[model samples]
Target: MCGIVGLFIKNPELESELGRHVSAMLLEMSERGPDSAGAAVYRNEVDSGRIKLTLFSSQAQPDWSAFDRQLRDFDAQSTVKPHLNHAVVETSKSLQQMQTWLQSHAEVRINSSGKKIEIYKEKGSPASFIDSFKVADYTGTHALGHTRMATESAVTTEHSHPFSTGDDLCLVHNGSLSNHNRLRENLRSRGISFQTDNDSEVAAGYLNWRLQEGDGLDDALHHAVEDLDGFYTFAIGTREGFAVLRDPIGCKPAIIAETDDWAAMSSEYRAIAQLPGAAKAKIWEPEPAKIYSWQRQ
Candidate 1:
């Protein structure tokens, strides 16, 4: 089992400790997945779009010092440090150029040019890595987090959740898909690259394929449910907001909470109940095969 949580605050300028809120939820579910934990925070700045690059490996040790040396020259704000078996870099650049620059770095995956989208994830307990690096120090109104306990694959930074298919698009999932191997083969045959052996990557590839064919986020997600087999709960995030959906069978758990200022969701009611102002809040599980769309307004 895995734990997934996400929230979108209405006011970007508001002084809500979103990082703290999300980390708390993630930690609350620590026992669910002690193997790894991660959180992505979204920020909106004047006009300088931000980018996120995740560098991970089990065979090669990432040289963050060298990487920092490479991007220090860019005329943009950036943050870099060690993350379990990887390094996360947040910068400002066009997606094409960033992808081109990272083509040679097999250990790196770049998500470029969106609102402040900084992904902080690692292969360990939530407290272990989340504290080593003050990821919460970077503020954002909307964010997503995941605590992963690998059921069918090796544990590595590459297999962490909140996998981004594009600059602002990320997907966090719970539940095992019985047809992942077949789906993985299908995706590879279609020329999609996969870094991890986890089934969630298949979900990411499905979304990427849909977007490549010009489908919007909502349609892409709707299509994914029909195209994918097995039980799953996916919290898909975009630049504006996020969408949550479950397979028709409702094999996995998920809960949603809405307030005048925020919308938070998690794989369980306990995580949602942990949110501020949620002590007496009403929370409900979205029906199976139904989609719940929450905007950042």
Candidate 2:
């Protein structure tokens, strides 16, 4: 089992408070998953043609300056900001070529990439990790977070949740998948690669593959309900929206609340209760096999 939370700010004036709202929701779900925590935030785009990539290193202190110089050699203007063992790199190079360059560097792993997304994750309590990362201070239009209980995988930073397989797209899962190995193999044959053995990562890759094939986020999730076999609830984040989905059986717990300013979902209602307008928000449990999405207007 795991905990998942997502917040999408529909009101432009409330965009600056996205992180605070999400952080509080995540903290409320801490007991559901105490092993590791992760979050993906979609902030303002740096530039029209630039992309942001979050990279993680196993070392205590990575040589970010050296990596920046290497990117410059490829004619990519870049800037790096180190936070704990991970760094966020914004560059004006093509994502495909940057990924190829990163593959040649064994020490650095790309955690997430997009024009407006930045992912941060670590192997520790969600509360403590939030404090260290100052997640509440971030400003963005939408955010998704995960707290892992480590049922199928080891407790490591690489195995954390909110896996990102496409630019500005991320997924956080709250249940187990029975046929993930089979599905992973199928995706691999289609040229999709995975960083960890976690089933959540495979789910993220599946959605990424579908989107790459020209399916919209809603269509991709609708297909997931028919193709993937398991009991799961997923909260997916994209560059322009957020989506929530559940298996046909709907065994996993989930609740959603939407106000004029924002839409929020969590594993439990308590997580959403403390939001800005919870009392007046429309709250309900999402139906099984239905995709609930909120997009920026």
Candidate 3:
């Protein structure tokens, strides 16, 4: 089974150090899925009244280096230097403006952005990739991640998990979504855009578009369970909170662990046990079709 993992820390103060812990936990579970890996880590900076956006190539291009320099000149308060094919930019403008500008380039995929959050993910095992930014260096009250063993599509960065359906709303799925072709067409008819043939990205885009139209996270997730045909477990991360759901049949395996300090869930208990103090933490499995949600404190 593809490995899926998530963490939601109650105390914003504790969010700072979680990246190292969570990363360590994820690495330990990496063996479960060696094909490709990705993560969406949330960073909440006291609403300094800024919009932080993450930009990356939809596919690597020859102009990336030039574009990187151009982006840095765009009035960002600060910028994270490009790592691999992605960069994080903290700006004062609305995400729409940033998207509009990036769209002009045609080579960039505004990846994912929104209120105090910016995330980038790539295909390939984290062990082999040198992430420009480390989670330990970033501060967020919540985050979610995944590693994949491709079952339907080729291994490419765009096909990686934690597909950003929208600014602040992203999803990492661990199972094949049957009937996704038709579902993709259905969603496209409604104006939702997709970047890859990957079903996981399609699921994320569909749910994000639904939420944009006013569907609650829970409702969108329930709709996914009923409408999307397949066995899947998904971790959805949003600016305010995150939620995980298992398909009605629960064909995939997942386990959860909790502590007074943090909450973590993954496809295996070994993943959760990888976290610090987890040996003494309370751990259990989320019942199939059940939902779990937590917001920053």
- State every prediction's TM-score relative to the real structure: 0.87, 0.96, 0.90
Global fold similarity of model 1 (TM-score): 0.87
Residue-level lDDT of model 1, residues 74-183, one tens digit each, is 53476675665566666666566666776666666642235556566778888886786465565676888899989978887778887876657788898888888988
Backbone clashes for every candidate come to 0, 0, 0
| lDDT (Cα, tens digit) per residue for candidate 3, span 1-297 | 688888888755687776776676668667877777777877655265677666776555445557656766775454554655677666766777777777677867766777755665666676553243465555677777777888899888778777886768888888898889999999999988888899888888789877888888988887777788888888888887788798888889888888888888888888787776788888777788888887764
lDDT of 2 at 29: 87
lDDT of residue 283 for candidate 2: 93
Q: What is the alpha-carbon lDDT of model 3 when measured against the actual structure?
A: 0.76
TM-score of candidate 2 relative to the true fold: 0.96
Whole-model Cα lDDT per candidate? 0.76, 0.89, 0.76
The order by descending TM-score is 2, 3, 1
lDDT of model 3, residue 152: 92
